[model samples]
Target chain A: MTIAPDRLSPFQDEFYSALMQAHEGLTEAQSHALNARLVLMMANRIGDLDSLVDILKTARSYEHG
Target chain B: MAYDYTPFPYVSPPGLTAPEARHRVVIVGAGPIGLAMAIDLAQRGVASVVLDDNNVVSVGSRAICWAKRTLEIFDRLGVGERMLAKGVTWKIGRQFHGAEEVYSFDLLPEEGHKYPAFINLQQYYAEEYLVDRARDFPELIDLRFKNKVVAHEDRGNHVALTVETPEGTYSLQTEYLLACDGAGSATRERMGLDFTGQTFQEQFLIADIEMDESPFGPDPVPERWFWFDPPFHAGKSALLHAQPDNIYRIDLQLDVDADGKAEAAPEKVIPRIKAIVGDKPFRLDWVSVYKFRCIKLDRFVHNRVIFVGDSAHVVSPFGARGGNGGIQDIDNLGWKLVAVLAGEADERLIETYHDERSHGSAENILNSSRATNFMTPKTPIEALFRAEVLRLAHDQPFARKLLNSGRLSVPCSLEGFPLQTPGTGAVPSGRAVVDAPINGPEGDGWLLEQVQTGGFTLVGFGDVQLPEVDGIARVGINQRSADYPCFTALKGLAIRRYGEGRAYLFRPDGHVCASFTAPEADAILAARARAMGAELEPSR
Candidate 1:
């Protein structure tokens, strides 16, 4: 499965901008901390163990050795 | 238009000349709470003497938000309609993060309620209207302006008060000394009571500005607008509310170490106002800089001398809970005190006021405190969490609930209280009765108006005949002609809200004490007895 056209609907660009804006003036460590919290919150929003596992495996495919 | 601050006449009391007879009740402070307390008692055929140091209504627009539950209680006290007409009605609240809107909510989406979700009116207008309403019962409510309670001693059976008036000092006695005195209560101080809770370090500059144009801009409907890190005031919270007489209330969060005097000065305030309104012609009506505290007495009912309103508890203004919570305290205490005085119930019934309203005040404090903490984060981690929450709130539905702009006042439920008999229905036991439109033989009316009488009431919905009980009024909805007052539920909203074929028993304060699917005469009596504190007796 690939990213759907409606992945975040019309808010795709807006959401991405907001995500970047969240780390506007934070240090690298603080940015990483924010990313960690964001991932946890998004995972909580997704709220499905099997689907989260599938998504985790799918995201791992993008990582190159 | 500015409100005229007319001072009420200061008439010296009879006690000034000679020792007056022991009164039934004495309420300190003639603010909204004390005046409303006196009016509520008077309506219940219990007379009270209201004393106050000041002769005027609240100076500024202190508590601008009057919630629906408070309005219903005010309606019973005779000033609800007057306020509803004079105040700006609003239900929608919008929360913003910086320049972007995060979340919005409709407080009362559905209709059929007599009053709206919330109304914004100057506290002075409400107090003035209450004073006018309090005058309707001149024989019952003795309003003595400039009467300061210098000292009070609880004398087992009664309270002895030393009041200083413009004429001279005088001695008075009362069966119950109700300390409706506000946050800085002299009465509470005299009693040496401990008021414990959290006080925030952050100070807010609240100003009421008048302008011909709406700050909400072009074709604005009055709504509560809250912003965090708003563009005008970066990295701080601000609130805008519309009140009567073209007055708009704006609260701006100030730095923890901001000079209170400087922030409240017109020089400093004008630029802040201009920053938000942008060259819009506006006049500053009132401005004050102050921090908020969430505090309450360990016990509201302290023997013969009981506390009500701010004297009992105080909360931050975040949730509009401070004033609304005080009004709820009056609603809970007034009926119980009247019952105890009239011998309809044991004195222990008054103790339940402490049990119920203390719980209510605690709930308000908890909510308002949490919102204040979220807005004014003490730690960097807390700020991070809040910022992330606001960011997610703009998109994720689940994240919206995490936003703490102010919960807004709703009637707290007393479901598990001892006075309430557990049952199943649309309105749960021990919750405030929901208002619904109805038409009776005489004319159209609301369900709350009929049920909120000064005595216990039984509302029979569709074929559930009201049981005949002494001292309890009966009303039927959508029931065929019998004996008691019957009404057709307009649009069947009453029947829908209150389950069909169910009998709801309400206390004098309009809270559902019990509900029955199959109501029995003996069962109804037992429940009434239980509500009146007979349940506290070992014989029961």
Candidate 2:
């Protein structure tokens, strides 16, 4: 799915930019290291993604129906 | 690869003596608050020492409920994921009167936070997580366990502390001292600060038990379950909270005639639980009695030493506000301490910690007292009122407001002061922006999210230029989207009324320092300077 620029928000964009920057100019091993950090950071920052997904899905479904 | 070594002689003997080596800041009590301060100072590259009488982080469950704000603080320290993993996330709470279901509320429905409603993790686990994280910065923080502060003298320039450890007594001098030494703070007592408030005549017995019959059923709800009436007793109620693992925290009302005090015996609690849940067998893991009291110190600062956490003020645990309030206290004090130590602000800036936190503590105390009054009714009239309110909430949305008032944890605004810039419109109170996501130019999440970045945040709705305040960041967001997802529907009108063209200056701990219609760089800087006790030219 395509990420909306506005939907990402400036804060979310900054986080995404930081994560992408960490991945740049890295060896395969280094990229993996940064990826692990990003995963944990994302998990902590956006807790229980399933719940958020459910929320967004419900909102979308209600709007459509 | 030899490290430089220098042995300093002991300054004080066994009891109390003047500190020989002066530190930038000295934090008393190695509990969560002290550790949090150490982490905050360490992030700012300031050196500090955290002293505690207990050698190890606590393993017991002193506090179980972790608020959304605090989870964000833990996230900044980079351990929030680990905590979230181990904790139980709850959003819905069921309130019952005897066997009759009165009303229920969904915490998650009121959305703007990126974090969940709340997490139930033992306090000891949080402390251990912090202690583990602190290992990365050994130089920035000196964790001295089993070291007790026996005496302290506030010299005009610095505070002299006398600490006694098992290794022998020693004196350490520090530029400033933070007393987070619990409710019966020795430092506060020694400094002659009076902690005045009303103590409930009734005592509550709290037990963490493993039970076969789930009082809340098997569905799992994050909201606090309250049973208002019982056949055995008229006014007595029981509070059941689902903690991590198979553990459940049960708070039962005790009769004045019970054989022993509530906390003294485990047997005192089991009978009460059995009376409510019938013959449900259970094994008690831990039990204690809490004497509910709503007390605040008249002043939070005594000389160069400032109080934080339970040392400064304490609230009734009915609302689970004590630990959350204490952590927020450190969040308030941490940034100011950083500014002072880094020479960005003056030492007088530390006084705001006293001014702002004291107010926050008083509010929490008032909220907790109100919750306690509702939970355990003292008079028949009060009981009738509480019953009617709960019953009405089942039908009316307005009635839900009274029940939900104390549940939501929102930061208090620092508006209407000379230091803050007053705009033409009214500033949103706690209710209006209660569930709004911590959003601005920086991003959208909870207030703790911004604080985790360990710097000040400038939240402006309209086109406000970024100010030149040191250690502060500015974020400009569309006023339309400022309403948080969870609270959008709940407070849409309120946000529109008061939030237009406003700018809020949030401290690293997430409380607002100064807010304005437009960014007033001079006023904001001056307020920060005053809070940090920094030397800045007066702005006319």
Query: Once superposed on the true structure, which residue ranges of model 2 sit more than 4 Å away at CA?
Result: A1-65, B1-20, B211-214, B231-234, B257-264, B275-281, B379-408, B424-452, B459-505, B512-540
Give the per-residue lDDT of model 1 (tens digit) for B1-540.
889999999997999787898999999999999999999999988899999998988999999899999999999998999999999999999999898998898999999999999999999999999999999999999999999999999888999999998888999999999998999999899878888779999999999999999999989999999999999999999999999888999999999999999999999999999999999999999999999899999989888998999988999998899889999989998888888887888888888998899999988987787778778876565676677667656656545666777879999889899999988888899999999999987899999999997889999999787767888899999999768889999999999999899999999889999998777889999989899899874321
Error of 1 at B212 (Å): 0.3
Query: What residue runs in model 1 are displaced by over 4 Å at the alpha carbon?
Result: A1-50, A53-65, B537-540
lDDT comparing candidate 1 with the true structure: 0.89
What DockQ do you compute for every candidate structure?
0.07, 0.01
Question: Against the unseen true structure, what C-alpha lDDT does each candidate score?
Answer: 0.89, 0.65
- Residue B46, candidate 2: C-alpha displacement in angstroms: 1.5
Worst lDDT run of 10 residues, candidate 1 chain B, spans B392-401
lDDT of 2 at B282: 72
